[model samples]
Target chain A: MNKVWWKILGSVLVIYTAIAGLLLGVPRLPILNESIRNLYFHVPMWFAMIVLFSISVFYSVKSLSSKSEIDDIKAVESVNAGIIFGLLGLVTGAIWAKYTWGQFWSFDPKQNFAAISVLLYFAYLILRNAIDEEQKRAKISAIYNIFAFPMMVVLLFVLPRLKDSLHPGNGGNPGFNSYDLDSRMRMVFYPACLGWILIGYWVYTIRFRIRSIEVKQQAN
Target chain B: MKKILFSLLLTLATVQLFAQDNGVEMADKLRSDGKIYVVVLCIVIILFGLLAYLFSIDKRLKKIEKENFPKN
Candidate 1:
């Protein structure tokens, strides 16, 4: 979509998210209470983070196979956005956990996994900076990016299920699967997720354009 | 697609278990008095507006470039 339309669509989605989140994100029902409402933001942030990181990995692969500068740019932008969302997800989740679990930072599988993912990307950025050759940097970064996805998948998805913890969905801990979400909450929750994902994409696009412009300016 | 379905299933189970718990009702009642939701709403609205504005400005720049430097 063009810029104006993107703004318009994004505005509408944000408005929708706000209204829906306020009405439903704060738990009012008999089962979930208020802490449950954090799902509107926490879960979706992580979802967007994963989606963006996955996109980065895809672009990294493309850049490797074709030696395309465009693919390299895309990989960089996606990873940058992914990191932002990942940090936000981590902070929001910590807050949610504090309220629900009475602790700020637990050594839970999910928490540790997320921290590792963030550190991995931090290394990715460093790798890019340490290299002077454009093609070499792109290739190496792509190789590193590929490794990131499996690490994330294992940390976020696999490890949590393998062991028991107080965190949701672990060790018989309550999670989205074990709990009964009301239909009313679902109405807003789905849209909230879509809105967040779209906004994430929107942010990525803007950053990508800016990066492209900077590259052009440098070349000229 | 399958993952989405699975996530949904997992979500359903979590919600079911939550609904069965007895203390949630009391917590909900107390939460309603806090009005934190309103703050969240306002923050989201502001963020949306800022991003939209930034995107529009970027679009305008591109349009200007296209107008000034047309390829023959």
Candidate 2:
């Protein structure tokens, strides 16, 4: 976790993606046109968010089992990092929607659900702050994190698909995999997802370290 | 009336086919003009700057951790 090699690799891969994503030949589909390239920049935000939230839930479960304050801190920091990525996903999705879907906020099922899931995390953070006792706060919030993770998955992955949505992989619309995401695009897209995920983890670790240090200082 | 409606439908179908045949408009001209590189360079610079800042923060945090927790 402390290794520097992965961090360096993540930076290199992201730089490569930024360059290649713009230069690479993408599928020329009507309506989507050049904006299809946004798949590289926009979609990865949600991927990173999901990965970070998964990490948060893992730590949350560990905290519940062990009753450790550090584990609780880890869970909270991961959620904090995940929320940043989620917001980025929302903003980028909105911008992409504006050109393609004809509006910034279309009240699409996917968009509405994404927003609600983010609000759900916001509630977790608020719930954490509402508690005054240390162990009590950690225990309650960890349990909340456990519930929030699955709800987030259902909100993002399941509910949207059940209803009509302008977003891909939902409603009647075909996902990028069925068409458009050809070999040429995959070269950049996969690396972009991985690079962003690594970067998200890096940010989470940094926040965790800083928070840990602050906790130690308070104790001393 | 049926003939007229059928002809109109055929015309609409031909127009759709023609649109597809023309192909989806991409930024081919921008690529050929060699200006896309400029945008790529600008984004790379911004990314580099952000990563550098993050690394510096990590380095400083490591220094503080070392000073505070010598045993660790």
Candidate 3:
């Protein structure tokens, strides 16, 4: 509630990015052409997803140490928000790839790893649901969350870089790094990441509040 | 030289895409006519509408919590 201004800023930034991203002139690279504009919509989803998942892992660590119910609630909500963003990123990436690469699923290293990492999170949700007792569920899932976060990082960030990837910056493929370093694209891209990440957090906060309310209701 | 050639091909590709799709326009006309505002407007409307729904849910949840949970 007190952080309402940031939420407003986030929404404003997203809208601004959307409009500007459409109208702004890009480098006119081959294969990308106008679709380079997807940088605003698609790339931000992954940034937001990673931010949310990191928040989830942080809270999982908190719950493990402090053993607080609120911490677990925060963890679960962050993961829920994270999964939503990850799925959005995947779908958008697929659409962009289809228009450019001539296929929906190219089995690109980045894409394959991304799919596996998302499945890892889905497995986290399944693990959570498999447990019945509240504290037991929280502790076990928190552990699974902590366990899963590192593998996801390796899957998404580290491994992709190590191998030949269709994505930029990997396998010697020219990626955003080529244009991202010195271009007007940076002007919109960074803000887009911040905006989408804030929006994800806003959603996470609301989900946490709702779950907290449910917890109180159950108590009564 | 390579960049120029690639750009030329890409431009043709975009043009070909526009030329091929008639019944299902790719908004090429809208973009060329500088009427992308229409697309922007529609997208902004959808984004704001979703945010508005979230805002309403937040308000309702707060009210329910206030009514159901005693203040300590």
The candidate that wins on lDDT is: 2
Q: For model 1, what is the error of residue A76's alpha carbon versus the real structure, in angstroms, after optimal superposition?
A: 0.7
Best by TM-score: 2
**Candidate 3 stretches greater than 4 Å from native:** B1-34, B69-72
Give per-model TM-scores: 0.79, 0.89, 0.85
lDDT of 2 by residue, A73-168 (tens): 999999999999999999999999999999999999999999999999999999999999999999999889999999999999999998988898
What is the C-alpha lDDT profile of model 3 across A32-86, one tens digit per residue?
7788889889999999999999999999999989999999999989999999999
User: For model 2 chain B, where is the 10-residue window of minimal lDDT?
Assistant: B25-34
Superposed Cα deviation of residue A56, candidate 2 (Å) = 0.6
- Candidate 2 error regions (>4 Å): B1-34
* Proportion of native contacts present in model 2: 0.75
lDDT tens string, model 2, B32-60? 64688779989999999999999999999
TM-score of chain B of each: 0.50, 0.52, 0.50
Q: What is the interface RMSD of each candidate, in Å?
A: 3.0, 0.5, 1.4
Docking class of 3: acceptable
Clashing pairs in 2: none
